[model samples]
Target: MPRIPAVPDAEAGVVGRLVYRLARRRFGSVPEPFAVARHHRKLFWAALVSELGWERAATVLPATVREIAVYRTATVVGCSWCVDFGTMLQRLSGLDVDRLAHIDEYATSPLFSPAERLAIAYADAMTAQPMTVTDDQVAVLEREFGRAGLVELTQMIAVENMRARGNHALGITDQGFDAACAVPQGRSLDGSRTP
Candidate 1:
């Protein structure tokens, strides 16, 4: 259980209930973070709106590119909630979820393309404290993605860092997004690491 209990869908009043139901339908469950955020109703609405806006904006990047970067960032930060949610998103999008097993070795793994490896390396650098982002990393990212794409990638990684860290600090954990959500491909039934 989370440090904060999820606000039950049935008792969240009309607006909360509707929001909860809509998110549940879209995501296969109302994410635990969303439910906990309900304690601050106004902020919850803002967060929901902001998330939707980011989703629309990120469409400029291809699905595989965005998901791999996001997933790598989440894993680097050790956010189980983000990992679980990201795995489900990848599965729902029909990306190769099993390939994630090779992510930690992306530098040498053929499973990740050149683009993905670069993005993953950048995510790794940025996630580390006293960040190690180098000139070569920026140059490569800028060349591959252009300035705007680099900006998007940086913002997405930075945002995930904030989210993952916050969720970890708050004792907010996964809600079975990679198990109970839409037949997640690579998660064990007990939510353990699965090969």
Candidate 2:
């Protein structure tokens, strides 16, 4: 359970009620983060709008790049929820999710491309405290993907760092978004989001 109780359906406002209905229809259930945010009505609605806005304005990077950077942050922060969700997102995008197990060995693994390795390295730098990002590292990224792309990449890594830490600090563990990919465990999805 979250620190606060969710705003129950019966008492929700017009906008909140509509969003809740839409969430249920689209995602099979309201994601716990949204439900938890609903405890603070304004924040809940703002978050919903923000996420929808992001969806409308497509991410500046490729799906694989964005997802990998997100996955790296989740892996570093020990946020099983992000990791689970990231894996599912990757799989759904038709990326090679099978090689995610080699993430820890990306430094020497041939599974990832040079560009991917650079992004993963950046994720690691940002994930580390007192980030050890070097001038040379930024130079390499600049050479690989000009100034705007570099800025976008850095911002994404920083954002993921915040998200992973926030979700982990809360009691939000893995919602098992990758239920089918890891194994065939017969667990109940009873209390989790269906998306």
- Score every model by TM-score: 0.88, 0.81
* Ten contiguous residues with the weakest lDDT in model 1: 181-190
> In terms of lDDT, which candidate is strongest?
1
Candidate 2 C-alpha error for residue 181, in Å: 6.6
Q: Stretches of candidate 1 above 4 Å error?
A: 180-195
Whole-model lDDT values for every prediction? 0.80, 0.71
- Which lDDT tens digits does candidate 2 get at residues 31-101? 66676677687777677777676455446667677667778777777766667776876886799998887
After the best TM-score superposition of candidate 2, give how far the Cα of residue 128 lies from its true spot, in angstroms. 0.6
True-structure RMSD for candidate 2: 6.8
Clashing pairs in 1: none
Error of 1 at 154 (Å): 0.7
Off by over 4 Å in 2: 3-8, 56-58, 180-195
User: Residues 1-195, candidate 1, lDDT per residue (tens digit)?
Assistant: 778887897768899999888887898788988898888889888888988888789765667877888888777666778888989888988999888877867899989899988898888788877688999999999999888888888988888887777786777877787854222345432223568
